[model samples]
Target: MLAELIRRDVDDIVDEWEQFARSSIPAAEDLSPEDLRDHARLLLLAVAADLETVQGEAEQHEKSRGELPDNSPQITATAHEHAQHRFEQRFTLDQMLSEVRALRASVLRRWVEQNDRYDPDAVAELIRYGEAMDQALTESVAFFGAKVDQSRGLLLGVLGHDIRTPLGAVRMSAQLLERTKGLDERQSKAVQRILSSSDSMRSMVDELLDFTQTSLGMRLPISRVPSDLGSVCAEVLAELEALHPERDISLACEGDLSGQWDAGRVGQMLSNLVSNAIQHGNELPVTVTARAGAGDVSIAVHNKGRPVRPQSLATLFEPLAQAKDMGGDRHSGSSGLGLGLYIARQIAVAHGGSLEVVSSEQDGTTFTARLRR
Candidate 1:
């Protein structure tokens, strides 16, 4: 899936480059050799860089999967070397100028042949096509720029929002500590609880900021070391146990469980799932299970809660789309950004995996994350 996604993205890049190149060539009968050489050199350089980045990422993935053939890297390197060699050996600035002049001459001949009896309607249609193409290219550039700006704005906004809650708690706790100088044991314990909750809120805010950054297209600098899925699960369960003592949480690992993954990301994904289960799974016992196969590992979190309606399931992973309130009183406390599941799914996809949900009135809801080994 990751490879396919990367390939599609690369194809889109190539298509955009081709369209830009086609549109950039001037429609004059005469051209300078220097200009042609400059254009071709720049275009070739951009294409080479893009191809190199895509191939490098693919090689890294193949290396992670232990499936990199011995000749693959050599072939990639050779292709790049050949492109560089051609860029240097095949055409000098003067040669490019000559080529461009020849191309201009050819275009002029074709234009004269087609210009003798051109209908007014055909001329107008061609003008309209050019205008539309220009408009489309302008809009595409602006749209991408706006998306990048919006992503940055969202990252800053979320960071500020995440920080405010914990800072407020810390300030409130400090005031209470100063005022309750001669308080009873219960009052002191209450103050301590406030301090503890403040600390937890701070940690959660950090995680939220990190998760937001990752979701907003920040690449994970992952190291390909052998990792134990069971150990990651156990650590996540232990952390969740501390956070939610009122609920019984269990981790079940079946068979030989080992894989290569970013342990921190895996833990974060699990933490998000378990946290969601606690928040929306009611007060029932939540169980997390993990199973590893030849080339994949699956982790599932099950909670005994009301089933989700079929209509709500479709948009569950969409931003700001929450599961409908199963009952009037249920999920009353889940009033936030509604980004947990969305972030979890992003993390899963980033890991070349996916998160899926299954629910019914008979059994309860289960969210499963499957990562490739």
Candidate 2:
């Protein structure tokens, strides 16, 4: 009966709902009256349809918890679609949820105010209407959360793709400066800095793309090429040394060190680990040990300093995970994005390998990566 009551006075309910949206949600500041009203109208209609259906007591109990699998999909589909559209409109989850509650409340208040004669069946009707409204809200929340994730993935994908063009141009300009005949030593060194910065930017952009792809439910793509593991680690270490000339970094290799892997990705992993060591353990020499086993290869970067906190260690390989003041400053002077270890671990996993860490006051921090050769 309330569902029918709602259908009869839907226009007045929508007006009241829009008034609440305008006053409550800051994201609605720039939206027109229609935009501010958002999905509440369709959702209210969906809720009305759901209430009109004849649900048995068993199904009613299921509906109360939003678990009416048989009927919910068809009943709540419009609400879910409205949720996705609202996400693109920049409505916060809480704001959207609030509007749903307002719509339900407005409908009930109207029904109670308009009718003087109250029937015993009105109570049952109210309960059913409430359950259906809640079910629709649940569906909307689910779709809203998914849309948030998708939007983030798309943003990262676009950002990483768009930033590379300027980076490549800067690198080329730096290279051209290096070839200038009248350049002094200072000018050449500055050019090298620009070139080095370009390399760092490119690496970051690549990591961002990888992060975005993975967040979008894709694996980190890698191309396997014939390569020497020793050569890969060696070049990575050389770059670190060139970047941090004052720091002492020692690399020790044992057994055969050649393998078939993505040389660039492996180098990226090594660079992330070694750079982490030097930045965290600058007071002491950073040690890198590489070994090629019968069927696998292992590389670990060791440094002595303060141990990583237990809480920080748990999420160390998590993307954007950073410890307070832990990422202090890098030798390259660029602030870390907190994705280095995360992307490194992803690369390792992509290559059928694993990356882990051990840290203590006594033994220090050691990041080890083991890969199938």
Candidate 3:
């Protein structure tokens, strides 16, 4: 009965809904009347048609849970298209939801006005109508959120990539300055500072690129080739030593550390692990060890310092966990996006490996990464 009522007064209902949308949303000021009315009418017709379909108790439950397949393709398509249009017009999520609320209210008010009093059948039809409208709303919200995420991911990816070119030039120039003849101690120190800052910027930009790629449903890219884990670990340790001349760190390797893996990515993972250790290890010695198993190799970086909080252990490898978990003194002198450990774990997973950590007062903290050959 409600479905027939909607069909009979669809035009009037759509006109009122469009007017409400135009008034509530500033973005709608630029939209033509026809554009605002088109999807609302189609969505209303789809909901009315769906209300006429017979459904059992089980189906009703599934519909209420939104587990049922959208039986009306038009409802889904129209909602998706409407959401896209709103997103392109720079409409906020709240504004889009307000339009749905306005449409539902207009239809319900018309139906109630036509019916003199409440009846059992009318109440049941109203519930079914609400479920239909809810489904449409869910679809629209999902589409709009996805579009926002995709756009943000793309913007970060492009910005990060474009920044690398200029950043690389600055780093190279600083390196050249460090080698320039007849430079005083202060001048040399300034150049070294520039080089160090550039390295930090490069690391941040790399993390941003990697984070965007993974957030946008893309896997961390890796190129597997014949490599030596021992060599990679030694190279990473050497670089860390150059960067932190004040710190004491050492590396040890046992068994054959040869494997089929992405050498550069593995080096990056080790670098992140060791850097994390040096930063939080309270000026104590940091140890790096590598050992080969039957078909895999494990690399561990151990640090002697205050133990990581028990509650923070679970999220240690999560992006931005550093900012959330590490505060005050622990976060001092640390300038990163907190993506280092997260990206390290992703690299391990991409190489068909795993990464884990253990921390305690007596034993300190150790992060171990195992990679399959």
TM values, all candidates: 0.53, 0.82, 0.92
**Index of the highest-TM-score prediction:** 3
Clashes of each: 1, 0, 0
lDDT score, candidate 2, position 96: 85
Is 2 or 3 the stronger prediction by lDDT? 3
Q: Write the per-residue lDDT of candidate 2 for residues 279-322, one digit (tens) a residue.
A: 88946899999998898899999999678888788788878766
lDDT per prediction? Answer: 0.60, 0.82, 0.87
C-alpha positional error of residue 347 in candidate 1 after TM-score superposition, expressed in Å:
2.4
Off by over 4 Å in 1: 1-184, 220-225, 326-335
Model 2 C-alpha lDDT versus the unseen true structure: 0.82
Q: Write the per-residue lDDT of candidate 3 for residues 41-144, one digit (tens) a residue.
A: 88999998899999888989998889985666778888999999889989999999999999999988888788898788778889999999998999999999
Write model 1 residue lDDT over 46-155, tens digit each, in one string. 32333333335465456335455342333334333323332344333233233334333332344445466667754543333232223322333344444545556587
Where model 2 places Cα greater than 4 Å from the true spot, the runs are 1-4, 19-41, 48-71, 89-95, 111-134, 325-327, 331-335
